[model samples]
Target: MAVLGLQVVFSLVMFTFLHKLAPYFSVGRWLLSKRLSRYLHPTNDELKQLSSGNQPGKTTGQTSKAKRRAEQRRNAASAQADKSESFTVPRNLPIQLDQALVEDIDLVPLQFYSEYTWLMDFSLCSLVIYVLTEIYFIITPHRLEFNLSILWCLLAVAFCVRVLASQAWIYLRTQEGGERILLVTFTFFFLVFAMGVLIVGDNVIEFGIEEGYKNFSTSATKFLEQQGMTSHGPVSFLTFKISLAFFGMLVGTLLTFPGLRLAKLHVDTLKYSQDRKITQLLLQINYLLPLLLILLWVKPVGRDLLCGKTFSKVKPVFYEDQFEGFRLLLVVVMCGLRILLMPKFMQAHLNLAHEKIESIKKESGRITNIELQKTIARVFFYLCVVAIQYVAPVLLILFLTFLLKTLGGLSWVSLFGETAVSFFTPTSKPGMKLPKLGGENSTLGTIMDSAAEFTSTLGDIRGIFTPVWYRGILNFFLWWVLTVWFSSTSLGVMYYSQNL
Candidate 1:
């Protein structure tokens, strides 16, 4: 508000002054040019006399004075041009370099931003696959139990993506100028989506450990006991899916490390705040924060505090409980390390932005050069707007998935209380024992047990997918509309770029 007020006041003052002087501006310019020309050059006849050496010594003096004034006028014109360009220069992408005055940009941060942005878009597309696969399981929980169903779906998605990319390329060839950026953004979006869906679905492992009471006794033991081992325990590792998912997620984290610099940069202002209201900052945070939060705190804490149930000892996502009651100590340490390096990224981004601005300023000494540089910046800015909005829907989905697991899991624990623990946690006592069921009833027991497993499996399937889609799809569409609207402005700018 304060900034807006100052701008309004400044504008009113400048316009009022300009309006009062409107009558005199042209007359003053003409008078000034005429007075300067007297010093700059004599009349044409006087120049002829000087060139013919008709006035001898007087002509030499006049000619030397004329030469000095001409040089001064040229210098003044150059300085005025510099002054005008400073105010009129466009504030967008400045990729051009001046041949005479150009310097190499050492802190090349924009390329990293480009790559990081692409990776994020790609990762969001990957998340859609996860959500879609989960949705399939929810709708037909009884069927599609076989892994091959999902595998085929992934394969189909990849093929479809390839077709779409080719079509997009053909369509892009039909367009030119800034409009092409819109096509490029969507083409790459689909391409990233395909990669996300295909890259990690091939390798899958279905692992289970059976637990039941035996010998007409209440004591529970694992059916798949370790070979020749006396001790009975639940599976000591995470589901293979979670394990591989964690790995893919970590690599994604590495890809987005550079973007976190925005968190620390411009912290004193609202420019790059950590608030949910700031959509650009939110989008960036949503891209990386959820997986990070899960990796750091949610999974580890849930495992320990949820109940006696815990994450498998093998490849535990968080550190051991040895951190003075903070099981997420290692996660905290790792995230802190990532934070520590952010200032370097911020510095790099700042250096690159400043360098681009300086390069444009240095090159903007002529009207043509000034217009050219400003046009480049304007187009670049428009393209960036398109890029930011293009990936918004996908990123929102990814963050929604993260929020579901973290919040839903916590809510389930709270709502069910101890019953939830008892239900999910396996029988506490573990030992191999004999069943005392009579032969006649043995078959009945077997059927009943099978029925129980089916019920449990169905429940697990719902648990896996429903929360992801519950509000996810609806919210995505709502935000998707807003993004399209925001990106439409870029489309207009793209159209305007040609005239620029």
Candidate 2:
């Protein structure tokens, strides 16, 4: 069967064209460039002038040269004394920063802006291709030999993980701030937690990994035998579970800061948007939805309770199939909600400058002009970094769900009145030969056949990379990732309420 399908073509276009177009037309850049209320940083000279009782908007007789000489004298005296001395401005001085728009063109040079823009643009393109693929399947008679949208999704997931790892790396490399120690501690904790959870019987957690793997192994063995192939089935069960735990550790590490940042954004958004009751309500919902998603997979809490005996006596509220579809749908909706409220979150992050100024106003000690300026300017400087942290994890879960739906052979059509599309049986017309590369005797055709043969051989030996195999693996990781996100976010919220 030819693997080069319409979806594959779309993937190729996305890979090639999007990189060029992203700089000029990117959702990340658009989101960041939106007109926002920002506080300007006070210059060192301005701070000194204010300290010297020079009110804003009033011209003093002092020349720029005079100010420089005065600053130089103060610096020399402080240097000789081996200590610093600086003038202090009034704590409650009425200082209003000049408001400015975060121009789209200015974002090109900001740290992480390019990375954020590319990730967002690629993810968006991949999503469009995925929807088109779903639509293509609906009207076409041919069954997909392989969903190439999975490749796009896999790449999206990879990029998201890389962004997350890079973000985490920043903390690990820090010499001070206790951030490295804190991250290491959390990674170790999550690792221990992941290992501990693996021991729990399927009855309690109901991850179904064990059952899924057994089913996969049996299917792979039979399929290989029929193909004149010999092999032990997939990796050992113990090895599989151990690998999952280690992956959980990595996820835990990557998510640590994002979760913490999420909590901070949530609190700040809620604080600032108090006047807009609707926005506040949405903020609360966005913050809490992950917890709801986490609970849905637990058999005792989610499945047994809602779809339990009481509801099952007459008829189940959700059939087994419908329930699974609902879980996928929920993740999609949650991700959408976050994206929708992105402006509010970004604005809240931007307002950190104002908030810092307010915080400094409450302090009694003198602050240097450089310190004050950085306290305000740093927020704008790293706006894109904050944005990357905010969006990476959300995209991670969203694309992962896309992969789950395609690779697990689940259907979106099922949610909208039709039965789920099952990929288990061939949907193409009977006896139709799947397309081959070029002519049978051509070099391209031979190379394609060789490649296909190699792929088959690899699958036969490594346990068939079947939909069922992916279903089980994706199902567990999807649930685990959700649990980790909610856990970390919950901890962050507590830390803010208690400590911050």
For each candidate in the order shown, give its overall lDDT on alpha carbons.
0.33, 0.77
Candidate 2: worst-modelled 10 consecutive residues by lDDT: 71-80
Q: lDDT tens digits, residues 1-500, model 1?
A: 34233323433543454456533432212211222111111122322343354542222345576564444343223334453543222223222221111111111122233432333333333444444534443444233133222332333334323332433344457655643564445434433532343232212100011111111011212222312435443333234224433433322222121122232232322233435365445444433443443322233344443333363444533233222123222223333343333332333223333344555556634334344433333322222222222233223333433333332222222233455434543343443344645454588777766776886656554543432333332222222222332233334434434433
Segments in model 1 whose C-alpha atoms lie over 4 Å from true places:
1-141, 144-269, 272-292, 295-300, 306-500
TM-score of each: 0.25, 0.84
Clashes in model 2: which pairs?
Answer: none
Best by lDDT: 2
How far residue 135's Cα lies from its native spot in candidate 2, in Å, is 1.1
Let me know the TM-score candidate 1 reaches against the reference structure: 0.25
**lDDT measured at residue 220 in model 2 versus the true structure, 0 to 100:** 77
Clashing pairs in 1: 92-377, 93-377, 215-434, 215-435
